[model samples]
Target: METASAESVRKHVRVYVTVFVALMALTLITVTISTLHLQPAAAIIVALCIAALKASLVAAYFMHLISEKKLIYAALTLTVVLFLVLMVLPVSHFADRGL
Candidate 1:
């Protein structure tokens, strides 16, 4: 039992370290993207995509959401849907104004 527990802890630690490394790599990519001087719209899109991935990593492992129940996933889906709607609202409004 102790061996099993120790193995589980090591596995969890490994996952955490991997996630940390991935997050750091993503941060570096973000910095590199910024230096590319992309157009504002393209840069925003790229940045948002990277940000979403980073957020997912944090939510899944750091927040222990990967092992959560269906109800939790449903709620998270709802939140994402609402967030996307909120994000689009401004863009749509600007489009309507010909901006």
Candidate 2:
């Protein structure tokens, strides 16, 4: 029993280490992208996409949201939907104004 528990812990640790490395690599990629002279809108979109991925990784592994209940997932989905709506409203407003 103790051996099984220990192995489980080791597996979790390995997963966490892997996630940490991936987050670091993504950060490096973000920095490299910043130096590539991308257009302002393109750069913003790319950076936001990368940031969202990193946030998802952290939420899933570090926050243990992956094994959470369906209710939790539903709430998270709602939050994301509202966030997207809030983000788009300003952009839509600016577009309407020809900005």
Best by TM-score: 2
List where candidate 1 sits over 4 angstroms from the true fold: 1-6
Estimate every model's Cα lDDT from 0 to 1. Answer: 0.90, 0.91
Per-residue lDDT of 1-99 in model 1, one digit per residue for the tens?
124477777887899999999999999999999999999999999999999999999988888787777898899899999999998999999999999
Candidate 2 local lDDT, 1-99, one digit each (tens): 124477777888999999999999999999999999899999999999999999999999988787777898999899999999998999999999999
- Residue 24's lDDT within candidate 1 is 100
Model 2 residue pairs with clashes: none
Give the TM-score comparing model 1 with the true structure, all chains together: 0.81
CA error at residue 25 for candidate 1, angstroms: 1.2
Candidate 2 off by > 4 Å: 1-6
- Compared with the true structure, the alpha-carbon lDDT of candidate 1 equals 0.90
- Pick by lDDT: which candidate is best? 2
